[model samples]
Target: MAATSHPINLEVDNETLAGTLLAPQQRMPGVLFVHGWGGSQARDMQRGRHIAGLGCVCLTFDMRGHEKTLQYRQSVTREQNLQDILAAYDRLIQHPATDPERIAVIGTSYGGYLAAILTALRPVRWLAMRVPALYWDEQWDTPKQQLERARLMEYRNSRVAPETNRALSACAAFSGDVLIVESEHDEHVPHATIMSYRAAFQRSHSMTHRIIDGADHSLSSERCQQAYTDILTSWVSEMVIGDRIGHLN
Candidate 1:
């Protein structure tokens, strides 16, 4: 029989390539994105997609009073909205590709407040909050829309203790990585509100704080929106990649 020339070149393969091929498939991390009150999942879709590209299972859902549930906006209570968050978290963790142990939650404004409380009820490895809003604990069962806006603003302007607030209390007990982003000129969530959150994460494994210069509460300008997105994605990337590397090593 005549000898045939081999089409494959085994000599070109490297140890790194071989190792990668032999490595076991890892379960992906799960990420849950919670949009602020008056916002819907649409706002977080892009960010979720970007993070999903980094090998995570990302989920974004509207709370009870938003989007499809707009009819409930006038009557939705904080308790009901919290239930929405818990349901979303459960759905994400139940995803087939998710690594339940390495879950992350990213929330903005009112959403951030609920995300913090979520940690107390579930397992969260990383948390990212942008202009997390603070509210009094007394009105837990009251309809969110019925709350006094001026009262909320005044409360947010003052310093709050971890022991006195449900969200802050949860933050006080969290031992995972955290990223707190603040808008330099946010009218809805003042600097004091951010400071209160920052101080509450006393036991976090690591905490990063960033201020988007000249950004307002709503991020009305495109520049401000982009800045916030950049800061959030960068932090999430570092945390997710570092955690994966640690697991592999």
Candidate 2:
């Protein structure tokens, strides 16, 4: 139940990234978790515990806004956010307990985008993306969808700060077994975004898309969270069994 904590100074830059280490009584796999907007490494505490329970080492860390990241300057660029991801990945792989080859990261929304981009840029053996925002959407048939999206953009403009936008923009280099999930009633990203991602990949066999019944954007419902955990664990199971031929779209 106890978790280890550490501070990692960026090797590429010089900033520091705060992280927490969670490990089970047994050694199995190493999972690095990246959270979404207003989320810290602790945002998905339950999921982290679950990963630990599965005998995997879990690493959770705060992004630029969550913890010690405040000490650094405010940044609003994809390059900067990718820097953070690279730093976090480097921190995890350098650990003596981590196999490097067996390590993976679970990202939700914003973090999902980062994980995708990072996988494309780095050497990731596996990836689990939860409703990732790294969409490659190109289809539009209805004008209503655009109008609705414009309204949503206005809302996002009023709420989220500019730095968050920069980070979101930076999450597009991912190319792996991207597991994209959608809550049936998600308030944030529409299904078209997922379609865009699918289109970008061109029916790539490295994607698994699922919809949690009766769930919303946050996956706050107990049933939704349970579904999320189950799907993620199953993905891990497949990875352990070396089943890489994933479903497309």
Candidate 3:
């Protein structure tokens, strides 16, 4: 005798399956690299490419005073460079693959200074600063090249508090992870400035401080540059992995 055939309900909720499968693929972390004064996006391209390999959307742009805008180096104000950073950040997050909530900013020296202040204005998940320079709040609109070299040197040597400095104030309120890299022999950004930044991160979820031995502010030596790249890439890798794991949990 032939058995009666029963039809199996093979249909699935297409919407539910699509949501499950597409959610994770929809967005990725975004990393924005801001180069130091006198430096251009070319300086950060390699590092940005490395970070991008770790499943992130990376962006690197020349600030107003650098690269094609070299003529403005002597006239560009910190405010203008800050605006550059803000614009780059906005463009980075707007990318189709970028997850606006998972943003990382890496900056060196003057760029670091701007990145710190940017935290106060944007949503940043990770911040990495190398020899972040400190500046007086009094010269907000003055051309960077015109700032008094002597007084700027003196101010960098002195201890500063979060309340008195804009960057420090931003650091004080930041609740994300932070990476502060110092050069052992950095004359441009004194030890006092690094300490001030370190102290200002009162609310950071985690802070990692590193010192590249016998290095200058610029990391001019090849070894020093390689060391910085290693440190930064490792820290970023760890942070990205942790972020992914947290999402899974």
Candidate 4:
């Protein structure tokens, strides 16, 4: 089926975030796509469009400091990015075509980090994270100099940060379904961090953890990219849309 796509420009605080909305003719489950850090909405557009073709409403957007608003890169903060993410979620859920109760959030890398926090903050039914980046609240919110200095220090108790705790708490409280995609050769996110994320979702009614072999953090190759998109679309179609597509994970 053909899908319709719309350009979206969101006004968040002092900067503008670029986004796109894709939808089928009929209203269905809603899915929001959050791109990784240093990435734009375009990175997820193909997956969003394909999901829309499967009768789902999808929204994909560029976070602050990324894509069209590169000028804001220097000023955008972790807090600001969180605000942007919340605003984007609100926009998607409020749309006339979206069914708020059946919503899925898909994010990659840093975006996946936000998605993890969001599932706790909002009533997200389905959650998907790919190679989610890890950060401590203190380090993430600190100045670049301080953050760099802290990064260079010992790796003692990395998972005890306030923000990480909050996300883990949120995930623990969420009783929906979760899908975690890991890269076999991911250089940014470590296996330990991925395991931590998986552990956080202990309360999820269903969880699917899949790894794409020979794939980098970005799934740079065409073959890996196709696998990423297929895994995501196929799972959402089955769990969210109730279609017997095929096995995922």
**Model 4, C-alpha of 67: deviation from truth (Å):** 1.4
Model 3, residue 159: C-alpha shift (Å)? 0.7
Q: lDDT tens string, model 3, 83-199?
A: 777877877776677899999999999999999999999999999999999998998999999999899889999999899999999999999999999999998999999999999
**What clash pairs does model 3 have?**
none
lDDT of 1 by residue, 10-87 (tens): 111120100000001246888888889898776687777677777777777767777656878999899988877777
lDDT of 4 by residue, 56-161 (tens): 8899988877778777777677777888889888998877778888889998987888888888778898999988876665555643223453452233224443
| lDDT of candidate model 4 versus the reference | 0.79
Selected candidate, larger lDDT, 1 vs 2: 1
Which ten residues in a row are the worst by lDDT in model 2? 136-145
What residue pairs are clashing in model 1?
none
lDDT of 2 by residue, 1-249 (tens): 344444444444565666777665543457888888556776566677766665566777776655666543234344565677788787777666666666777888767767766765667766777776542222222221233455653443243322234323333334445577777777776666555544455423476788898887788877788888898888777765453233221
In order, candidate lDDTs are 0.82, 0.63, 0.83, 0.79
Indicate which candidate wins on lDDT: 3
Error of 4 at 119 (Å): 1.3
Task: Give candidate 4 regions above 4 Å deviation.
Answer: 143-146, 149-164, 243-249
C-alpha lDDT of residue 50 in model 1: 71
lDDT of 4 at 125: 86
Each candidate structure's TM-score, on Cα atoms with residue i matched to residue i, is: 0.89, 0.71, 0.89, 0.89
Point out where model 3 deviates above 4 Å.
1-26
